[model samples]
Every structure is written in C-alpha cells, then in structure tokens.
Target: MIFFIYQIVTKPLTSKLIRNEACPVCNTQDSLELTLYMRYIAMLIPLFGMGRRTSVICTNCGNVLKNPDSSIFAKKKYSNKVADAVKDIRQNHKRTLWQLVYPWSIWFILPFLILILLGISAINKKNTEEKAKEYAELIMHPQTGDIYKSTWFENGLSQGVLVKLMRINGDTLYVVKTKQKIQMSFSKDEWNKLSADPAAFEAKEYKIKNFSILKETNFGDLFMYNNDENGKQYPIYLGAILNSKCEMDLGFETIERKK
Candidate 1:
C-alpha cells in the first residue's frame, strides 16, 4: 500500500546581536557580541517554541560559546548598555504563556478531501459514456433515412406491421402518416374506427406535411406506460412509445454487429 507523507520543518525566526559584552571563554571585556535568536517550527500553524537559544562571540581572540539559557550574560563584566539591550529584548520578545504547542488537526483532513473530489469525477465520466452509447443505438429507417431498429416487447409486433421512422429531432420522432398495406384495406367505417391510432396508419412519401412526432400530449403529465402488459422496458429514444405520455432514458442493450 502506498501512503502520502508529510514533514515538519524548522527555520530561523530571528537572529541579531543584542550588544557588546565581555567574552566568558576568552575573559576579554567588551570584546564579544551577545546574540539571541529563536528557531521556529513550520507545519499547519504558526509555531515558535522549540529550541530558542543564545550565542556569544568574541572579536579579539576569535572565541565562541553557546547556551540554551540567557543567564550567561550575568557572568560578564557589568555593562549598562548590554544590560539595557537585554532587558528590552526580554520584555518585547517574550513567548505567549498560553500555548507551548499548536494544534495540528487540520493537517490530517487534507488527504481525505482530495479523495472525495476524485470519486465524483470518475462517476461523471461513466455517465457521459453511457449517454453516448444510447444515442448510437437509435434505428435509422432506410426509406426515411432515420430511426433505429429498436427492440420490441414480446407479442408487441403487429404481424407485417412496418414502423417507418420519419425524423428524429431530440427524443421525439416525427412519424409520417401511412395507409395500411400489410392488412386488407379497411372499409370507410373501419377506417373511422382506427383513424386515431398511430398503428392503424400508413405512409407513401417522405416529404408529406401530415408528419406528427407527438401524440395527444398532456403537458402536465407527458409520460404514460405504452401497452406492454408484461412491464418490459425498452429504449424510449428508439421510438418505443410504451406510454401515452413520454420522456427519455438511457439504454443498456446494444445492437449486435455482424463480424
């Protein structure tokens, strides 16, 4: 398993010479520079209480000494100038008494935030690919040069019935009106009985104006189940009008290609 790693770093926050003082190592008066500095930590918060120390350096004999405490200044010869500088630094640069360490909880949450964004991106990509596949399956009727050879519900096919796709704009297909050619020609009274049904009509030309894509649509309630008694689901985009009121959904089945 791979894991992400984070690090905490330390850097110098302040470094400056306070004043000239006597070197303790070289025993030279007014020959050393008393310096006080702090090394701050860097992580998720502003932190500074780690190893704050002081260093004294001699100018005459090139000697240096270091200590964690500032009390080494008391061993030197009494100099009012160095003492005033030390007093000013102690008063102005004191660490906060409230917090010796900072809270680090936010650093643990960054990795989880990155994971949630990646999961949402993957789901959206899969949905886009599924939509593209559904569009490719629409049947294209040759005489009309439109519509796909969609799947039919079992026993849904009227014998010798031809479904001619006229035009496809969005999810709706404009089917051209046709006179029944497969069944015996209907009598005038029989024609009147079936005139309202799309299955009872027939078409001759591709350029006819009687083409209507929508049935008696109810704007408030536009989709109803088509006459599939077994509750079989088909692709709505394939012109499978299962219900009187209609909308579209993605298809799972695809047409098998010839090898």
Candidate 2:
C-alpha cells in the first residue's frame, strides 16, 4: 500500500516594526507590531506557498488584527496612516534564504536529473553502435583468438554456448564449442567465466565449411556455412553479437546447433 501524507502549514517569517501605528481594535498607540507569515502545502517537501499574511497585534491591549492589510482593520476603512504603516512593514519583511529554496526544489532539480539520465542513455547507445561496427569488422576477417558466442534451440529449450576459433584454414573455420550449455536467460558474468576457462570448451574441432562473410545488411554481415557432416546450411549473423568488448564477444540471436 502506498501512503501519501501532506499538510498545509503556516510558518512565521520576519517581523517588521510599524512605526507610529495604533491598533485599530484597541486604540492602543504605537503598540501595533506587524508580522509576516507564510502558508504552504508540504508533501515530503514544501510544495508552494498558498499565500502570505500580515498580522498586527497590540502589545498594550492584547488585541490581534489578522491580515490587517486586507482593507479592513476593525470593520472600518483603513486610514492613510495605517495603510502606509502596513505597506512599509510588508516591504521590510523578508523570509530566510532556506525558506525560499526548499519549497521549489522539485521545480529546479527534477528537470536537471532527467537531462542527465537522457545524456547517459544516448552515450550508452552510441557506444553500443560503435562496438557493433567493430565486432562486424572482426567477423569479416576471422581471427585465431576470435570467440563467437551463439544461441540455439536444444530439446525444445533455448541454450547458449560460446565457440572459440582455434584456426581458420583457407575456406574452412575450425572452432571449439563450450561444453557447458547455459540457459537463454544468460548473464554477462556467466559468459565471461566460460570464455576465460579453457576447460569449459570441447576437446575436438568442428569445421564450418564454405565460411565467408555474406555482406547483406548495413548493421552487420552474415556468415554462410555448410556443415560437411550433415550437409546442412545455416547462417551466423554478426549483428547477433552483443559484446561491448571485442575480445569476449557474445550473442543474443540464434544459430542452429551443429550436432
């Protein structure tokens, strides 16, 4: 359950002297003091000010005239002397600096945070695109240390495995598949662990016949292969590679598992 607690609170700000002013309610001379108050609504933080009120209280007669600047002091028209006195008091009253900044935190801080998040997201996407381009180039020119991480279906369940290139003979690519089959819901740490361990891969070599980069899409090229054992054709798309680092490449796309 979610609970929202908010309150409308009134806080006293600075007080100013209303010189030569008489309390209209008590007729007390030079006893009226003007105080400024701030009323605001708060939810976790002060949201905004409802309004400001100026009150005049007489120290001599103990009479309080709330919001004396509202045209009426005691059910009578405000005289020029009282009006000028209240105006001067209001002009002098100032709230503390903290009160000014706390209430508007959302207004200034939220947009700045949003912009920072957007900039980070844009940078991450740019890096991913750049890494994809680099991985595509690596795929075009097959290397000895190149690791091709691929996913395939096995026994009606999705499985993930890594294939490390041992060497590439003229038209054939020799590679070793990982012995441990990971679930499709794979983690980066799991991939890295398998890539770093030499014992995690198979002992024998698997040949991918007629292995060449088929320049098809702008994102990345495809590797067309003809498995010699089963005489089956399959594609290994370079775009499927999801590695941020070119050294330990991984894939999210599917490649048929060679038996």
RMSD of each: 17.4, 6.7
Worst 10 residues of 2 by lDDT: 250-259
* TM-score of each candidate structure, all chains considered together: 0.27, 0.64
By lDDT, who's the top model here?
2
Model 2 ranges off by over 4 Å: 1-5, 48-51, 60-64, 68-98, 101-122, 148-152, 184-187, 208-212, 216-240, 243-259
lDDT of 1: 0.41
Q: Taking the tens digit of each residue's C-alpha lDDT, what string does model 1 give over 74-191? A: 4654356655664566556656542334344346666887788888877766765664443333322122433222222224442112244555555443453334323322233432
Query: What's the CA error at residue 249 for candidate 2, in Å?
Result: 14
Candidate 2 lDDT, tens digit per residue, 30-142?
Answer: 78776777778899788776666667677778776656345433563446775676677667766655555555576788999999999998877786677666555566666
Cα lDDT, all candidates:
0.41, 0.61
Regions of candidate 1 where Cα sits further than 4 Å from its true position = 1-20, 40-51, 68-223, 229-259
Error of 2 at 252 (Å): 14
Clashes of 2: 0
